[model samples]
Target: MKKSITALGLMSGTSLDGIDLALCSFNNKKSGWSFRIEASETVPYSAEWKRKLREAENSSARDILLLHNEYARYTGEVINRFLNGKTKPGLIASHGHTIFHQPQKHFTFQLGNGTFIAAETGIKTIADFRNMDVALGGQGAPLVPIGDRLLFSKYDYCLNLGGFSNISYEEDGQRIAFDVDPANIVLNYLAQQVGKEYDRDSLIAQSGKVDDTLLKELNDLPFYNEKPPKSLGKEWLDSELVPMLKKSSLPLPDQMRTLYEHIAIQIGEVIHNSGTMLVTGGGAHNPLLMERITACSKAEVIIPENKIIDFKEALIFAFLGVLANQRQINCLAAVTGASRDNTGGTIHLS
Candidate 1:
């Protein structure tokens, strides 16, 4: 195994917030795995690019294929700009923009072609981190648990509040993880309805009151009752969740407030009566959401420094690249319900 590795991780989440780039270094020592975020930034997507990506899911096959390469080239260009006068990484691992994720159908797709990224960046690249797991009957999600187990063992639970809220933790000597519920995806959509990008500090939600009827309806959704090894995607949100919210006919602020309560309840159920829970991701910055989660779960929630809150997922993706490069187990079968633990990611050598 390599003693040390520096890699750049790129992540484009479902919220269409931006592309997160984390340049991280990993060191393998006798104690365990240690890491440092040498540099990190989130390059927000332009209106045109956001529209293209948002509409890509419904586009014709030819158009989707074209956008895939176009997005990859664009990503490479962004990396080039980000790395200007910075340390050039040994590897680049991209989670890509998730366009279609349907593990139940035994397939998933993330845009941004690895070959194009490698070609444009002139560096070893790793992408397509989920297809193999889906092929093995896995959800192809919550991929950061392995990092939680190895790199963040000190925390009892690691909850990431990105486009969606997912939790990872050790249980019975195995890493268990799954999507909890919607987060920024739903919130951002509602915010956009009012000409805002997102509910800053969850102010919109805090200003409104939770409708018990809506909250109850959301809480009773069958997805929440499902067991672990399950996941969610844009399709599910569009088909199941979005319609429900629309049918309620409540005011937008009430919808946002009720949704926050619903999310807190679902997460509370998962981490009920637990130890310390480390919260990260963009949602961690939302004071109201954090307060609701704290009130519901009764778990001591610890929000780390700003860097970790915003870039932990990207940092872990870089770690995933390091493990994949070494042919070590990066995706856990226990967490993803794959046929077996496997090294996930396709290497595109430059």
Candidate 2:
């Protein structure tokens, strides 16, 4: 493949944090597929934009469509600002901000318009990576496993703590992945209540006491009892999680601490509390949470370099674009329970 391919990847995760942009170079060598992050940055979302995205979860059909195009334009502008005069990559791969992801209902939708992105940036764009798997009677979630299997197979487990926490690992000669539990989504919401963007190393949670009752309730969530090939979404958060948290009269810090411990416990259950695991995502930066995870589990959680922690999702989305262009399998049926392994994504020509 002509030495290597450079692609720009954009990720608007469920965390309502910001858009992550990574310009990555990929090479398929005799050894295996490898990638290098040439440049990357995260443009934090404005309060106004974040409010619109959160509210769009239940907005009218027409409003959702308008927001889709508006978000695409916003994404493109953010990319333009980040690129600033740097050379454009060959392709743009985006995991558009998920406005709705109800796989059980047989539909999933991401907000950024690929056609609009392509037109704005004058680069071919690939997005909407989840719909096909849902259509195939699969979870249509956790599409990142293919990249985990191909790019970071050295670790026994790959855990990402973003808006939500999800894990991927090899099992019985097949790659398995699924959401673990809520992470930054809930944490950030609580932080906002205290006028902070996040817990800042989870100081809030660390300084407080974990309410045992809340911890028990969180651990008892029915979603945890489900088998593999499952997923979670904002609907679950609103309908199941938020109301439960609201019932607690504990202070915000105690609530954060309880949930943090709960997240650690749920994650520990998956790894059986042991293995060499690679942890990445914005949540990786929370030293307090990381410490709790280590204390609760026997797993060796290795937090990688900063760029890898921040932009790995973006890099993987870019790899998905490369695979989609080549008609290669980028979404694994074994992971998402799709009818078959499929090359996910739709290409929008420049």
Candidates' lDDT values, in order? 0.93, 0.90
lDDT of 2 by residue, 38-106 (tens): 999999889899999989988999999999999999888888787888877989998999988888889
TM-score of 1: 0.98
The regions of model 2 sitting more than 4 angstroms off are none
In terms of lDDT, the best-performing candidate is: 1
lDDT of 1 by residue, 257-341 (tens): 9989888999999985568999999999998988999999967999999999999999999999999999999999998899999
Q: What lDDT is obtained when candidate 2 is compared to the true structure?
A: 0.90
Model 2 CA lDDT for position 150: 92
- Clashing residue pairs, candidate 1? none
The TM-scores of all predictions, comma-separated, are 0.98, 0.98
